[model samples]
Target: MQTAVGVFGGEGYKDGIEVPPLMVANAGQSDRPEISSLNCPPFVAVELCREHLGVHPCDRRRSINEYRSLFPAIDFSLIENDDDVLWKADTREKNEEVAARGLKFLSWLWTRKEKEIAIVTHSGFLYHTLSAFGSDCHPSVKDEICKHFANCELRSVVIIDRSMMGSDPATTNYPGKIPSGLDLPSDVADEKLPDEGKVN
Candidate 1:
């Protein structure tokens, strides 16, 4: 008999955390029958898949998925955390207590299995988010990200998700759930949100 395990844990503070015995048994247990076609330092820079998630209302801010998209390959089943919605812009439904309204179709982008993804959004989102690239680069590079993208102007950029670069692929984010509500498509019920001590 043999076993293998991968723990993709991030820094966090929680009141109570527990592990199932089944997982404790797999500490050194990875024997993936198939090696991922992806190479070491996994990354995709070609043939991006253009995705459409329909449309939804929004008063835009850095979306919850924006944080995760920076590392899209981390399998979702292993993650466990809350949906941080405080940054919500008053751009859509006024229910600040509920962040799903702002997310609309955005969450779907993260679920797609394609390694190369193309996101289509307004200039405002591109302007602010691209700023995350930092201003220390070449003047033109800084100018491109900082400037409003003119109509039909296309720029090539690279995003890095360190998790996929050289880490074991079998890790997990624990009890994390996106949209914070299991029913992301329908109205998110308040109760479905994870209880503080139970899920954090």
Candidate 2:
């Protein structure tokens, strides 16, 4: 995740990168103060995101924050208050619940008017969350990005339903789902990129 963000722009990075400032799409938005808080090993997605984000305590060179910290990048504002972790995963959580949360997140992004953004995430969880947006991919960009993102790879995508993005998405405000009978379509998903044709 950090690697993905770093590629856009970070300390020690040369100026004139393509993307805009990065925002992390954490696998599980748990704000645990220590690894012990996680109890078991930091699950696959958690571990990988920490590794690249420079927040993992085990790897000093890679770690920037203490543990499970996303400072100097993802501000506290983006996260939910208290221990109500945004994307925290739970064993008892139902797939429908997960899908609802994922859809709400997409809607939140839409509310923020985020056209293009960066996501710091791992494979399994990526699919797990994105799959909820809809069963299928948006036809136009699907071919370009394919099914999933490869290791530390980059791709661009567009939202299909444009409604799924409604914190709980506006679409839910009224009706028996879209006319298609599917939740608004969205892609698994970038950081801030400089305005094109502009010379820095």
Candidate 3:
């Protein structure tokens, strides 16, 4: 069965890592399914999707400006901030707020029967969304999921149904339930992550 997998870009990717050629080749499949993102680095993911999957994103944004020569056939959206709020905000609640916007997009995508779908965004946003895929999740479990993803890493799941997703999607930052050693949203607010590295 064809699987839709999200590919994180290697912008600030640690060790100068790049998306695997095999993954890029897989994304270049003949089906040409729609790719999606939160309007920033996901455009980098879009480029990956087109370069690897042979599909174009459903909505386009200008984040892929650097790839004009490589992905000449791709048409980018002129819409400003179409994929906003995923990581731009400072507070956990604000972050969750934008993530909910992303969740809404995914829940809508789940309605389609297209065997696979891919989303590309920064590690932090990706971690939050992945954790939200489970029910009654423990903070440790969420922490574990958040810690595992690295730049250009591709993680896939068989979402028979979005069992973990709610009618109204929200982020699981647990701002009010902070663990003892974890950094608070404010503490990490100004932290600038390289597009190519693991968030942790």
Tens-place lDDT per residue, model 2, 1-200, is: 34443454343333454322233334226432211111111111222222211223322222324223543343334332333332223334454554465555555555544455655655534554555443243443334433666887665545554344443343223333444433222322211223433577
For each candidate, give its TM-score against the true structure. 0.29, 0.41, 0.38
What value does the lDDT take at residue 134 in candidate 1? 35
- Residue 183 in model 2: shift from native, Å? 18
- Best-to-worst order by TM-score is 2, 3, 1
lDDT of 1 by residue, 1-200 (tens): 01111122222323454322222222234432212212222222111111111224333223324423433332333223334233323333223213232233234444557666544444544555455443444455466556877654455655544344554332222123212323221223334443433544
Off by more than 4 A, model 3 = 1-70, 75-93, 111-113, 137-144, 162-200
What local distance difference test score does each model get? 0.34, 0.39, 0.40
lDDT of 1 at 120: 41
If the candidates were sorted by their lDDT against the true structure, best first, what order would they fall in? 3, 2, 1
How many backbone clashes does every candidate have? 12, 15, 17
Relative to the unseen true structure, what is the C-alpha lDDT of residue 159 in candidate 1, on a scale of 0 to 100?
51
- TM-score between model 1 and native: 0.29
